[model samples]
Target: MTKPTFDLQSHSLHSDGVLAPAEVVANAAAAGVQLLALSDHDTVDGVGEAIAAGARHGVAIVPSTEISAVDGSYEDLHVLGYGIDHRDPALAERLRAARADRELRAERMAQKLNELGFAVDDAPLAARRAAGKPIGRPHLAQAVLIHPDNAERLEREGHDDVSSFIPAYLIPGTPGYLARTHPTVFEAIDWIHEAGGLAIWAHPFWDIDADAEVLGAIDRFAAAGLDGVEVFYPTHDAAQTKLLADRCAALGLLTTGSSDYHGPEHRLFRTFLAHELHGYAPDLSKLEQAAARAAEAAA
Candidate 1:
């Protein structure tokens, strides 16, 4: 069987995702992914295991991670690092701080939810994953489900999915939202380079504010050493994907695509293959090509 020339971005239990690193890679090989990037949110703890799994399945693994950044202009931004040195001490320290911020934010949000009568304890978020791993809204959402009030609410609303309850109240602009103190976008881009990685603006259309002028922001980010744009993402509708593709071409920026798979509802089985984006093949070759460039530049 021929290997598919595509790289899929995914997360693992190291972050908000449910699967362990090995399970994520196993699913990738099963899904016919030739290349996979375990770009777990704000952490790279799973990259090593994913790499080992890749070797076993004859699939290549690119050590990658995603970081949350506050561009200082936008409400929030996420940066994806490709070909990063997960072992780098500087990179590790940055991610550690970010995860700590996540913990703090979770505490604050849980406090607010309790004020609203959800009465969830912070223990659930801490124990949500392996010890010391970062926790996020998903864990909090699950914690709230165990609360009598929330259980009644979910039953009343007929919600069988925990994630389906998050955005309705926990996300930004909602009752339980608490903004995180993230690194500035420029600092994040530089951190990725310092860690021997190429930085890409990840899921811009989703992470950015709906009313923000996205193209103008992308142009500004390009000046901050943004290497590529995540043009092919599951959340991007066909028209939105095309707009991103055209913007990348106009800006002379590199392009990437991904399933951004987490688990279950966002499984690889249901996600669109990165290469099959409405006849416009996403340029994931940039992953390997930029790997060399990042190393040379960092050296």
Candidate 2:
């Protein structure tokens, strides 16, 4: 059988991307992506639309979610879930709770920015969220850029994307920062597994020093039934990818890759378009193997 070629990670308007879930599916079809996943942040609301779009585009749409997991010390540990049951009551309740928490955080962040003399409207943020598109830091960053006093400063500072703009002034401990509560890694992994999905550690090297910390995290995740690790992320170089791949191989963990594409709106544009950088490509064989293993485990 011929191996599948595809991008495993992508976002739609369901989270923060510009395109709708259908549009994302269409774009991936155009990009020659035979297997696609709508790994929307925190919510699985777009999976149904993605499935409909995939049927139309002849692409396999994998049901996926990206959970924000934090350890006891409050470090960010992203866990990717695949083959999950979007309608599973337990999973849905958790996702809904997460969405609510995200809304609360965005509101708090907007209030903090307003108090800091930055122009932002929590109303529209809430309105957009009510319309099913979750509000995120990107909206807040854009609001900051449009502020009269900050506009010139933002442009002068060359903080174009959301990450840079937020990092400069809105991340935790920053001027306009407001910390949001995140789900624990154990909770998220358990939820994913219970929802008939596979849990994967995502982007271990970016912003997260996956040395001793990562090894410790890996141990915990393995005990919790983590099926894979994202070894070939756009954030990783060849050496890093190899190192992760070797680790996964030795540990009997499935390894996978993806562009983590969030369209043009995302601030992380530099790495999001990674496939074009080094002529890289995502291999769906890895994802398939992981999915198979997860299905077997669930069975």
Report the error of model 2 at residue 183, Å: 0.8
Most TM-score-accurate candidate = 1
Best by lDDT: 1
Residue 218 CA displacement from its true place in model 1, Å? 0.8
TM-score of each: 0.88, 0.85
User: At residue 162, what lDDT does model 2 achieve?
Assistant: 72
Model 2 misplaced regions, further than 4 Å: 1-4, 264-299
Against the unseen true structure, what C-alpha lDDT does each candidate score? Answer: 0.76, 0.73
- Model 2 scores worst on lDDT over the 10 consecutive residues at 270-279
- lDDT per residue, candidate 2, 65-124, as tens digits? 988767776545678898887768889888888878877877788888778767774565
Clashing residue pair totals per candidate (backbone < 3 A): 0, 0
